[model samples]
Structures are given as C-alpha cells and as structure tokens.
Target: MTTADYIALALFLALWALYSWLTAGSGSRFFPRLSLNRAMAERRRNWIYNSLRRDLKMIDTQILAGLQNGTAFFASTSIFAIGGCFALLGSTDKVEDVFSNLPFVYYGGRTAFELKVAGLTVLFGYSFFKFGWAYRLFNYCTILFGALPMMHDTNADRAKAEIAADQVIQMNTIAAGHFNAGLRALFLSIGYLGWFAGPYMFMAMTAIVVFVLTRRQYFSDARLALMDPVSDTKDKQERDMRT
Candidate 1:
C-alpha cells in the first residue's frame, strides 16, 4: 500500500479512538451531554438499587437476563463475521477478477486486495474478542446481581444493600461498555470494506460511519427522550440538560 493508503487507515483509527474517548466513562457532566448509552447506564444503576427494597426482584432479574442474552447474541454474530472475513480471504482471486472487470472499480491488484482482506480479518477479530469478553462480563454481572441482599436483609441493613447494589451497577456498566465497543467495531468494519474500493473511498466511508455513530450517541431523538431538561435548581437547570 502507498502512503495515501496508510494515511487513510491512520485517519480511520484516529477517528475511532477519538470517538471512543468522547463517549466513554460517563463523559463530562456539564459540557457535552451524556452519551445515550451512558445515560442508560445511570438508569441501570437506579434500577438495581431500586430493586433492593422490593420484595420481588423478577423484573430486575429479567432485565439482567435480557442484557446477557443480547451480549451472547452479538458474540455469536461476531464469530460469524470473523468466519466471513476468512471466507473472503480464501476467495481473493475471484474477488480480484471481479474487481478487474468492473470499469469503475479501483482494483488495486492482488497484493492490495490481500491486504484489504487482512485488515477486515483484523477488524472482525477485534470485534469477536470484545463481544466474547462482554458476554463473560455480563455473566459475571448476573452473578453479582444474584449476590445482592434480599428485601428483608436490605430493609434491616440499608448500607450493606446499597454497597451490593453498587457492585452490580459497576459490573453491569462495564459489561455494557464492552458490548458497545464490540458493536462499534462491527459498524466500522462496514466502512473498512470500502478499502477494497480504494484509500479515498475507505476514508470517506469511515467518516460517514463515525458521523452516524456519534449522532446516535449524542444527538439522536432517543438521547433527547432519555434526557430531562430540568435540573433541581433553576440556575443549574439552565446549565444541565439532565434532571
């Protein structure tokens, strides 16, 4: 690959890192709004703690089950994606022939095509690992959730109950974080596929992917719906978009 190709790849990587940082770890409270996922994380904490004082925890258990199941589903999908990348690698000759015959195609030749396929393989590998880890973390979080005190115990001792609930919250949040990361990698891989077209195409498509992802995280209607524009104090309410 030429320097332009390398530069394009670097740009994609840089944008991914920057977006990850921007949306990660709950973000700043007052400047940028909390990412929609992180806003849900706050709700996750509330849900777990609120369950502590309730006699029945079926709802909370069902929520955790859904999280674990979702994680597992994505993990399985990532495996299939990794397999598809390998399938592409094996069919590079046919792919090269197809690209060569297309008048508008970039057709960077066999070596470049191989490299592009390799990059895709790497992307799916990263996604698979993230999803696998997220699934395990979700399982661990479920265990932690189960360890939480029952209503009788929590009623008798609120502090211990709060601490246990906090543990569940942290574990659940971390699992969700890894799940988000895996999903991000999957989305970016779609842009990486553009590399087979040419470096410029790669860079352009990656930017579009990043834009869409960031918009969903920070500015989408779902985010606005989850957020409250009114804070407790009048001045603080004007400053913060969360209640």
Candidate 2:
C-alpha cells in the first residue's frame, strides 16, 4: 500500500488503543466520573452481595444464564463474520475490479485487498476467542454463585459469606470485561470497512467510531441512568428550578 494508507492504519490502531485504555479506567486519575463499563462492574458486585441475603436465588441463576447466552450469541456472530471475510477473499478479483472502477476509491490492487480481508478475519477470530472465554468464565461464575452460603449461614458468619460473594463478583466482572473487549472489536470493524474506499476515509471513519464510543462510555444517558438515584434526583431538581 501507500505511505498514506500505512499512516492512516497506524492512526486508527492508536486511537483504538487509547480509547480502550481510557474506558478500562486508566483515566480515573484524570477524571472523577466513571465509565459505563466501570459503573456496571460496581452494579455486578452489588448484585452478587445482595444474592447472599436471599435463600432462593432463582433470579440470580437466570441472570447468569442471560449473560452466558449473550456471550454465546456474540461468539457465534464473530465466527460468521470470519467466514464472511473468507468468502470476500475468495471473490477479491471481481471485488477489486469493481472497487477500481468506483469513483474516489483508492483500489490498492489485489494484494492490498487480500491483506485487508485477512486483517478483518484475524479481528473476528480474536473477538470469537474473547467471547468464547467470557462464556466459560460466566459459567464458572454461575457455579460460584450457587456455592454461596444461604442467608442463615451468612448471618452466622457474614465475613465468610462475603468472601464467597466477592469471588463470584470477581469472576463475573472478568467475564464482563472480556465480553466488552469482543464488543469493542466488533464496533471498530465498522470503521475498518471504510478502508475499502481509501485511507482518508478509513481514518475519518475510525475517528467517528472512537468519538461515539467515548461519548457512550463517559457521557451517555445510559451512564447517567446508572448514577446514584438520590444525587441524580437532586441535580435534576436544581436544573428544573433554574429553568
């Protein structure tokens, strides 16, 4: 490919790395606010601790099932995406011809096209592994949840019960982290598709994707919804009074 294409790809990867770092809590020292993922991780810990208080944990089991099912779904999707990339590679000659004929398209020739497809396949494969491992971790978390002491046992020795709950919380949070990693790869793949057009388009699309992800992580309505209810209500009332 050209120097511009290489530079664009490097920028795309750098932005992806930076965004992942920020969302993974590396930016906590610089910012007081929590990212959506971090906020949900706290909720997961609370849910696990709360489960220790209940004898019948059918709801907790169901939540674990849901997490496993969602991870499985994304893992399967990643596999399908990998297959699609291979299929595209198979038809690259025709696709290259079409791309070359398209106005404003860079069409970096056959080798470049194949290289792009190969990169996409690797990305999907990586995501599939992340999701697959996350699913297994969720399964382990479910078993750990079941092993947690009943309310009476917890009353007898709250410290021991809390330790067990903490184990489950850690497992669940690790699974969620891997699941988020897979999901992030899938989102970045959208920007990767822009590389088919040109390097400039690729960088632009990557920037746009990163901006959207940053907003959701640090400033979206979903993040706000997860904030403490009392504080949220107070802030809302003050704003309303001012208006």
Candidate 3:
C-alpha cells in the first residue's frame, strides 16, 4: 500500500482506540466517577411513582409505553442496517461491477471505491438518524421527570410509582446506550472499508477511528451527563429540598 493509505489506516485505528477508552465505564480506575447507574435508577423510580400517583396529567402509562416501543423500533432498524452492511461486504465486487456498468462511470475501474463510499454513506446515515432520535427520546424522558414533583407525603403509597418511573428512565437510558453502540459499530465498519487499500492500512485506520470516538466520549459534555447520573440526581434532590 502507498504511504498515504497506511497513514489513513493508522488514523482510523487510533480513533477507534480513543473512542473505546472514552466510553469505558467505572470498571476502570481512570473513570471511576463516571458511573450513571444511580441517576438512571432514580429516573426510573420517579416514572413509576408518577404513573401510580396519576401525577403525569394527560400523559398516561400507555403513552410512556408507546415511547418505549418507538425507541425499540429504531433500535431494530439499526440492527437491520448493520445486517445490510454485512451483506454489502459480501456483494462488494458485484456492487462495484454494477456501478461500473453505469454509463456515467468516470473513476476508471474504481467501482470498489464507489461501492465502499455508498456503504459508508448508508451506514452513517442510519447511525446519525438512530442516535439523533435516541437523543430526542432521552430528552423527552427528562421532561417527563421534570413534570413530577420530587416531594411525596411520607404516608403516601408512592413506592410502586417510583419504581415504575425508575424503570422507564432506565429503559430510556439503555436505549440511548444501544444507539451509541450502533453509531460505534457504524463508524468502525466504515473504517473497515480501508481493507481495499491493504490489511495493514485497514488496521491502522480502524485504530484512528477508535481513538476519535473515545476522545469524544471522554471529553464531551453529553457523555459526562449521560454516564454520571449521581451528580444529576444530587442536583435534582437539592432543588426539591429547597422547594
């Protein structure tokens, strides 16, 4: 492979490694404070409590269930997209040949490149849509949480309601996690297209993509907020206590 191809490959691999590291959880000492379990638990509990208490006004349990279902549908779609990528990989040569046969072919025997580009484009489009929708759902869940008052009468039977809310929030967070994972897979798969250059170049490019993703996960505010629930819950508690 040419030096340029090797450089591209190296960059990709580096990015992948970085992505992995940044997204890694509290299991590692470096990210010990980045755990989101507690916040997610509280959110779920609140959802259930609100449902039981009938505090959600026009928003019923059925609607909440529907929201969950919608997210599931998106996740399923992403899975199909991944399958499509694999299928494209298997039919790479045929895809290139078909495209080459087009009257407008201009790149001169670069049909494989065209196919690779198309595959990556599709994958990225799928990932972006999935992740974007997941983010919106998460925001919706947060708004639902905001609608319910944190304070409950000590004698009120709110345990079940709290549990339900918590469950919903946890599920939403899990959905977000799945969406992020889908994006990661898409990015890695795109990097895999580097195999057209050479095996070593492919490996290097994969690494670079890994590194880029990791850095974003580690340093991005969105990641910090999503992963560290304790701080968020604490803030909520403080607000409730003050009121």
- On TM-score, the candidate that comes out on top is 2
Better of 1 and 3 by TM-score: 1
lDDT of 3 by residue, 1-243 (tens): 346555654666566555555454524566544433333444555545545554434565465556556656655666676566667667767866775566533322455464555656565566657666775676577565555444463126456446545655665666556566555767687567656555565666676766565545444444445543464675445445545
Write model 2 residue lDDT over 162-194, tens digit each, in one string. 999999999999999999999999999999999
Decide which is better by TM-score, 2 or 3: 2
State the TM-score for model 1.
Answer: 0.91
| lDDT of candidate 1 over 1-243, digit per residue (tens) | 888899999999999998888889434654466788878988888788788877787888798789888878888888887788789889988887799988756777888888887788888888888888988998888898888888889889999889888988998889888899999999999899888788888999999999999889877767776665565243344445544
User: What's the C-alpha lDDT at position 77 in model 2?
Assistant: 100
Q: Which candidate should be chosen as best, given lDDT against the real structure?
A: 2
How high is the lDDT of residue 191 in model 2? 94
Q: Tell me model 3's lDDT, rounded to 2 decimals.
A: 0.57
Per-candidate TM-scores read: 0.91, 0.95, 0.46
Q: How far in Å is the alpha carbon of 226 misplaced in model 3?
A: 7.4
Q: Mark the regions of model 3 whose C-alpha exceeds 4 Å error after superposition.
A: 1-26, 33-54, 57-155, 221-243
| RMSD over all Cα atoms, model 3 | 9.4
Error of 2 at 239 (Å): 8.3
